[model samples]
Target chain A: MSNTTHPDTSRSSDESAHAEVTVPRSPELEVEQEAALRLWVILSRAHAAIASHAHADVARSGLTLAEFAILEVLYHRGPMLLGEVQRRILVSSGGITFLVDRLTAKGLVERRNCDKDRRARYAALTPPGEALVAELFPAHADAITQAMRGLAADDQQVVAEMLRSLGLHAAAKPLP
Target chain B: MSNTTHPDTSRSSDESAHAEVTVPRSPELEVEQEAALRLWVILSRAHAAIASHAHADVARSGLTLAEFAILEVLYHRGPMLLGEVQRRILVSSGGITFLVDRLTAKGLVERRNCDKDRRARYAALTPPGEALVAELFPAHADAITQAMRGLAADDQQVVAEMLRSLGLHAAAKPLP
Candidate 1:
């Protein structure tokens, strides 16, 4: 994707033409902004790759990425209702339904009617599902580590904490 | 999404075994990891919202997001051929052809025979296309800024820079 064009053209080529609105940055801020932009670009590509990789790995065991995520949560935290899994995975109701359908078909997960709320269904990992996670977690952990390979161990920890804090804050916001 | 359950499963109503695995936090690196995860989550949501917003804006002008990006590039950097645009947008040949077809149908972009390479076709923005960008940019910018509110200016810059750097590195990787 290299744009081997005139320097000026390539430098300002991505966005549309408009007067540059100055969100003035201090020296420290400027450095950070450049880093942040780079990270955004990296994260997009990295995310795509990670999703593809995770999907491929999970598909072999007859699960979709989101379904595997649900299974992973269940494997780590025991049984969870469909709605609870949906909230944690940040998928819509319809999406959760579809995901659960696939997982149920694969026999990796089963839905049991809740005692307290008949409308709710609890999804628990089957024996095979638990086995799969046990086998896959090591590889998945490796992939996560690989994704963070560029950063120092300390920096990676910092990144994780900051990102978790940010995610909690954002999740707390009332969606418009 | 909270898993509030009794410690002893024998006494609890729910039968399934629960195995919650919250990572132990290290004083030195926990914050960084939090930051990293939170950043990814924020970006994911922001990107989803931005995609929707941009889609609506571009649809009004009768173009797909990819085509709009092409036009934006052409408007800012003058005319460029299909291959150059594909490179810049980082899409496959088939994807670019489809995008060009959609843009051409809208009269926002045109393909001209490249003088330098007979086999190549140039994709350039028409005057209407250029004008459309000029009209839409400000509104798009405002929407983006709004979505990114509450992040301090310094944090924004830092995050942007980090993301961009990461993105560039990821983009540079060879496709598997």
Candidate 2:
């Protein structure tokens, strides 16, 4: 495999003042890399574990992850128009419509025309939708807490601090 | 959504003992939870980013991530049979066979019937497969390194460590 480092790397440590602290190379960098790789493998496997459980949860609730996520926003914020939900969730406009349609078909969400804007439609959770969230949110949160069981509070805090930098950097920037 | 903290009983801290350290109650506990949530969000986004890039990479090179992973394993370790690859990658028998078929179709990998075991098929990286890895491994590594930019080395190490623990605990285990 080609291992040549690219020059146009946007992640150049020089550009980001925080780079040096984030990626300190030890004298035996090889050991660190190996550890990092093993960690990555484990993380990937953990992801698969969560995904398997998540799939089952969704199945039990009749909501896919995308659908559940969309519903989650609505559940928190009351009702919002399709474009707004799409914007907040960073999903495509068309995909949001399809998701709303499916949720509506399942009697969980309803779409109503915006009073001010004829062209706009808002999606709101129905009674059943609210019920679904009520039934699922606790279990879902419990699943999260369960997944996080082995981590001590301090370790969790430290890991959180470290990952914040990585996360913020990799986050999807809003459309300029 | 309901936000109930069950004081009487909940397995929220069930696996903490496995960790080398335990954290006492403090303000950082909240930060820890937020950080953990943020990390999950970022990791999910990163997985999507990798998969999306993999889609493009595979389309251009006629290799799926599964196939590429297999070829990569074979590329480094020489030829190996189907079952071996399946075990190493933790993919199902049908999944590996399907991936092998795709790689074979692209002529980047080939299968050789094992002499000792008639039912076993050995798969190896073709010249094109080696060339694909040579061309793509650096960019792949860069994508990961870039995704992790902006964090402190100590933070990175902490993240790696926590993720390892989380990964291991979350992995498939025998029923209690």
Q: Pick the candidate with the highest lDDT.
A: 2
- Evaluated on CA atoms against the true complex, candidate 1 attains a DockQ of 0.18
lDDT of 2 by residue, A74-114 (tens): 76666888987775555666777888999999999999989
lDDT of 1 by residue, A75-131 (tens): 766888888877666677888788888887878888888999989999988898788
Residue ranges of candidate 2 with Cα displaced over 4 Å: A1-42, A87-93, A115-120, A172-176, B1-39, B49-62, B87-92, B115-119, B152-154, B173-176
TM-score of 1: 0.70
Model 2 residue pairs with clashes = A1-B134, A2-B134, A21-B153, A22-B151, A22-B152, A22-B153
lDDT of 2 at A113: 89
> Please, what are the lDDT tens digits per residue for candidate 1 over residues B70-98?
77668767788888777766567888898
Candidate 1 vs. truth: CA RMSD? 7.7
Model 1 alpha-carbon drift over 4 Å, by segment: A1-46, A49-63, A160-176, B1-64, B172-176
